[model samples]
Target: MPKYIMILLSIWLIVIDRCSGVSSPIKPFTLYKNSTELKNDTADLWWTINDAWKEITFELHIKSADWIIGLGISSAGGMKGVDIVVGWVESSSKVYLQYAVPSTNTTYHGKIYKAPTGYSIKRHAIAHKMLIDPKNVNLVHHLKLYECDPMTTLNDDQLPDGLCDEIVDEIKFCSLNFATVWAVGGDAMREFPEEAGCGIGGDYEIKYYMIQMHYDNSRLDSSTASIPSALTVPPRMEQFAIDSYCPSEVTRNIPKSGNNVIFALPHTHLQRISVWTKIIRNNAAMQYLFNSEKYDFNYQYENRLLKSIKLYPGDSCATRCIYNTKNKDKITSGCERTRDEMCLHMFTYYPRMNNFYACITVNDDSAGVLWIQLR
Candidate 1:
């Protein structure tokens, strides 16, 4: 009799669980800058996103309907992480501001979330910072911001819960230029030099920057930006090294005008002791684009070069990473996971190239790829 009673109670609980509801706030309007609606044919407005990181502006003129008007921008629909500016006229004009922002988001499952670019016109970003929830840092392996063509119309606002890559069409990209690549141990802030800037938005032909956040049961997983499989590090070896080469054939995509490198971020997991990039021209050495005498996984930073290095046509670059795996009893291979390993050199340069997105590569076979001796 007790067993029968328990079965009835279990069925009742299942019904209650199925009846519970989760509601997300309504989708907000898309502000594509060129959008101007003369509300009932009486208003004229022109607004757009600013050059600074995350800001927007508006100017509206209306014949009537004067009580409250707003240009609201928020991460959530209702109130959480809101940055809204409202105004009205009666006596000396009044403005109401509600500003609160929490830069990170948490999740219970694996997913990809995207945020709007705010601006659809040419704007230059001078600096950017990584914003990860301190408690959930372990969940993030990498973050990338992709530049897409100017979006005249975005279907819906990806707020509260971001645009799920699984449910939607895989977001398309128009340019090879990635705005940023932040990995596991990267520094919080990265600033560009005074003379140059990364170009985006309309006119620049690359607008609508989308921040792509990758969170799985563990780390970042992007089939497009796949890191080369790691090299084998034998147990009890004094030192192990991995190299990645961007063959000159691949570098032909670089603009004929050439590139001036301003900053570099060299990344690897815990075993790495040092990392550097060697540039080559005419099959001969040119310079070390960037180098680290000692690397700290805990203090990973994107370094701004004091004096920029130049990369012309017919130039190629290769990355080398040295590891200390002498204490381990097992072999390690290059991989994307936090527990595995990687060898990557990400650099920032401008007169931003539209045709060439990356010389991106990894040299797995030492026999096939070799760098010229250093000058």
Candidate 2:
């Protein structure tokens, strides 16, 4: 077991539409001619697919009504961070929907947020551009749009503009896979190439997406382009480094045609002095994928290669971030707050790979500090 645990209890859930009357205590529902049912001691679920509309409708019968029920699809493994939706009909009889990433959160006055909020894809579609929310104006410093696992079914409720702090259990899922990244003074949007895109309807469609925004109403440093004053950077060490990587085993999902990447963004908080990502093949350095010489926390944008880098089934990728922390004495590890630290590399690739959604592994990570049930 990990160091800490936070479990969300699931209570009884029932559903009966206003148009339909309740069933008698001794009587049970009869399965429709074309529908199927699954039942247990407390709940029964009936569902059927509408091929014509490409939709599936579900009805649930919970033995009790103490709590609402949430249902969605996911990978065979337990749902820690895989993109899935959770829905519940509140006691007010109002339907409530939310992204299944974590519990709904809120923002504070002086803190910077890196909230990964979810958005659902109604059908098969291709993403062409990712732009900063103009409404947010100078508040959003950096943003990353990540594609949830295609096989998952996640929800998207317009939760309040919230602060997204570090949730230990979500580190793996949230940091590994990113589809688009937009930073301060970046292009109008993160655009894709004409020849290829992430995915669209059918087998390649993404089910859900989460946009992690750094919400800090800080002005840009006009001269040095150094760390902004709004972000808290405590000096604790002379120098420190963080690393993130994708192993060769994860390359199995790469197709024979290869995966092509055009642009990459190596991200960090305020202290990084240098950053780089290297592609390794056959246990040797194949190419220096991206190396930011004099890293600047401000003025961050994507570094596009002259040509696309293609990777086959056996290739792997690694990234490193070096920080100068000589000023004060403080402890900081990987975290979501801009005041803390994060080392991540987000790149846009062509010909999406299904199972190869995420390959990042956090260095020196223990089991976890928190556990929030999403089943």
User: lDDT (CA) for every model shown?
Assistant: 0.58, 0.54
Kindly report the root-mean-square deviation of model 1 from the true structure over all alpha carbons: 14.5
Model 2 superposed RMSD (Cα)? 16.0
* Best prediction by TM-score: 1
lDDT of 2 by residue, 215-324 (tens): 55334221212222212344676666666566777776678899888887777867788888899999998888788878787767787677899988888887887887
Q: Which stretch of 10 consecutive residues in model 1 shows the poorest summed lDDT?
A: 1-10
Instruction: Show the lowest summed lDDT stretch of 10 residues, model 2.
Output: 103-112
Models 1 onward score TM values of: 0.59, 0.53
Give the Å shift of residue 99 in candidate 2. Answer: 17
